[model samples]
Target: MNGLKAGLAELEALIAAPVLGGCNLLVCPPATLAAAFAARAAGTHVQVGGQDCHWQPSGAHTGDIAAEMFADLGASHIIVGHSERRTDHGETDAIVKAKAEAVARAGLTPILCIGETLAEREAGEALVLIERQLAGSVPEGLAALVIAYEPVWAIGTGLTPTVAQVAEVHAAIRAVVGPGVKILYGGSVKPSNAAELLAVPHVDGALVGGASLKAADFLGIAAGAA
Candidate 1:
């Protein structure tokens, strides 16, 4: 929702960054740019992905993009149940589960996003809600997956949780998802606080937003992960 075709230049900048080993930089552009992004990122550490994906492979679901379509375009991953989608589209855990399964079927990794709103957090229901969403949304036997925890209130609000709070939630998430699953933090992530957030326990990566529009800032955050 935030990019124009000019966004390709950002991807190009990332592609030109030094190939630091073990650092995976994935960009999920709007469906409209999937082909071009994927094609450009081919053979590079910069991988292309999808912001959202439909559960079904092909259907009459107008304006919906499918996981298979993304896979066909060389997208290695797809985000399911992002907070915005949950709020704006009313996507449920069941719908996210179906989409995860669809992503696995297409040989792509599913990045399942689970988070709580400000009210839910203040009510002390954040962990409970996240656990419930994980149980309901994750399909059995996923070969590869990623979890993104984005506090709904913090997204684009320039406000973030304390490092301790992030650690607590991520630790709990780690216990449920086990050691293999990579958990990411996604709430106004930028270079300024990237190192602190990435250093938090159980945080394997970032589900970056606004800052990613600029390659220098995005790369700086990636550098923090190194």
Candidate 2:
């Protein structure tokens, strides 16, 4: 709840900033803040989204928000299978696949996240991990989905893979996802590294985190993407 409020406040400020006037920005806050942020983002370039959603539209789930609810609140996008959800909530690829289908059913785009942990990377199984995740997490029809490659070890660790490494993984993802889908890179992406990361082949944009919490940083990253 606190994070959602803080992120919405930050997004409000960023949208108001003159420097970020021309950038394409999307902020996926918690579902509770989706409506508020969408209202606040009106007349601005910033687009509001949801951090996650339940596959079922309306059901017996006690604490789950549905993608249709987010859509009703004006969310155009929703993220699924973020590393935090995968690790902290024990969400598997099959679950994420369901969520992605729900997002599509609700008429929203799903930004599906896929990545490998440090141990997996060290074992030289990063690509294998990504392939498995992709195969299981993504559905056959992917036109309504976006893929984000966020190395779990790099997220919030102030560490990132090299440009060559980023390019390699992104290319492999593209090959699997085919030419229609857009692939994004996420993992401690900031203005400092945004340009280089965006320059990598198949990297369409970013699913920023820490840097996204700040207006200057987020705008800088957006500019880098441009």
TM-score of each: 0.98, 0.94
1-226: candidate 1 lDDT, tens digit per residue: 9888999999999999897566789999988888999999999888999999888899899999889999988999999999999999999999999999999999999999999999999999999998999999989878799999999999999999999989999999998889999999999999999999999989999999999889999999998899
- Give, for candidate 1, the lowest lDDT window spanning 10 residues: 15-24
What is the per-residue lDDT of model 2 for residues 1-226, given as tens digits with 9 covering 90 to 100? 3365667668877878664434467888766777899898877778888999999999899889999999898889999999999999999999999999999999999999999999999999999999999999998866778999999999999999999899999999998988889899999899988988988989989999878777789888888866
Off by over 4 Å in 2: 1-9, 18-23
Q: Please report how far candidate 1 places residue 211 from its true position, in Å.
A: 0.6
lDDT of 1 at 155: 100
Residue 53, candidate 1: alpha-carbon lDDT: 87
Q: What is the lDDT, from 0 to 100, of the residue 69 in candidate 1? A: 91
- Best by the TM-score measure: 1
Supply the global lDDT for candidate 2: 0.89
Q: How does residue 202 of candidate 1 score in lDDT? A: 90
